[model samples]
Target: MPISHQKALPSPIRVVLLNKPFQVLCQFNDEQGRQTLADFIHEPDIYAAGRLDRDSEGLLLLTNHGPLQHRLAEPSQKMPKTYWAQVEGDITEQALQQLQHGVQLKDGLTRPAKSQKIAPPKLWERNPPVRFRQNIPTSWLSLTITEGRNRQVRRMTAAVGFPTLRLIRVQIGPWKLTSLQPGESRDISGDPQIATLLKSPKRKSYRSPRSPQR
Candidate 1:
């Protein structure tokens, strides 16, 4: 009789969605002793798929799978990310149009973005609240972009005459921040659909069907 051999099943992928708080470094370690993802997340094997600036806040994804991480973080993938920005003035329609078309930056002209004026979101108050100017009124915007250039959102708003005062990412690709408060995280490793998607040989690019309204 011939001996039978069987291949072992692959380990389940681990993915974590975290609502990163303002002022926390995106990395796990900080030489300056500043707060980092390590302060909140204890998973040793997982790493941030992409990064948010230390001053920016909201949804950040981490994963243990290298391919999944690359798919999410690579700028060439053109994954859309939605952000809620509180700008320094009553943003104008012209500004929104400019943003929707394209904005010139030092690097190059940015790709066209989906831009709209929106009401201020009901959100957790920041510890060091945004500076308030009694004379100047501020407005909010919901902007979605597919690029990952450094400070792209802030620069885009500033180029159109409204500097971003407070920026919060609300969604990335198909993942929504939802109700997760600052510093809170959820593990989505058991999602069978995500597992299957990761394993698919002919996977399509992930894109949001429509721009996020808020």
Candidate 2:
């Protein structure tokens, strides 16, 4: 029998949604002996879509599909990425408004962000926790922004005089970080979120997506 000429339907994209833990590099391999995505994920070939800093934790997506990765990783995509930031000192209404209106940074002015004080989200504890400052109280805030700048959340808080003590990404596009414990990851297939990643948010900006940390 002759081999059929019809091409098989493309296999569903392999998408890995990882709740990355603090202190782990976003990349799969690191030469500095630091922990990396490889420590938690042994899957081969797939690369991280966007970066989560070594000090930051939560929702980090990985995949081998280049176009899918580009859609999520591209700065032009304007996909809103949300974060929960535990900032030093109680956040003031003025500060929250400043954040919502956007603050001036060395990189210029950030696009307006969706920000509101939020109750501390129930989350896993970091191995080495943030310092306990008895004199200064901390508060949590949820922030959503369409631009991915370098240490943007931390910078935004600090710009408003609220230094971020801990940061965790809670969502990207339509995908939330719900229920996934630190360092846990799962395969996501055929979800509407995959389509949502490519859509742009309401605003526009020239800031590039966060580059992989060295």
By summed lDDT, the worst window of 10 consecutive residues in model 2 runs over 205-214
Per-residue accuracy of model 1 over 23-136 as CA lDDT, tens digit each: 999999989999999999998889998889999999999998899888788766777999999999999999999999988887678889999999889999997999978999
Q: Look at candidate 1 and give me any clashing residue pairs.
A: none
TM-score per candidate, chains pooled: 0.87, 0.87
Give one digit per residue, the lDDT tens place, for model 2 in 40-136. 8887778999788999999998988888887778666677999999999999999999999988887678888999999987778788999869899
Candidate 1 achieves a global lDDT of 0.89
Name model 1 segments beyond 4 Å from true.
1-10, 196-214
> Measured by TM-score, how close is model 2 to the native structure?
0.87
- What's the distance in Å from true for residue 34, model 2? 0.8
CA lDDT of each prediction against the hidden true structure: 0.89, 0.86
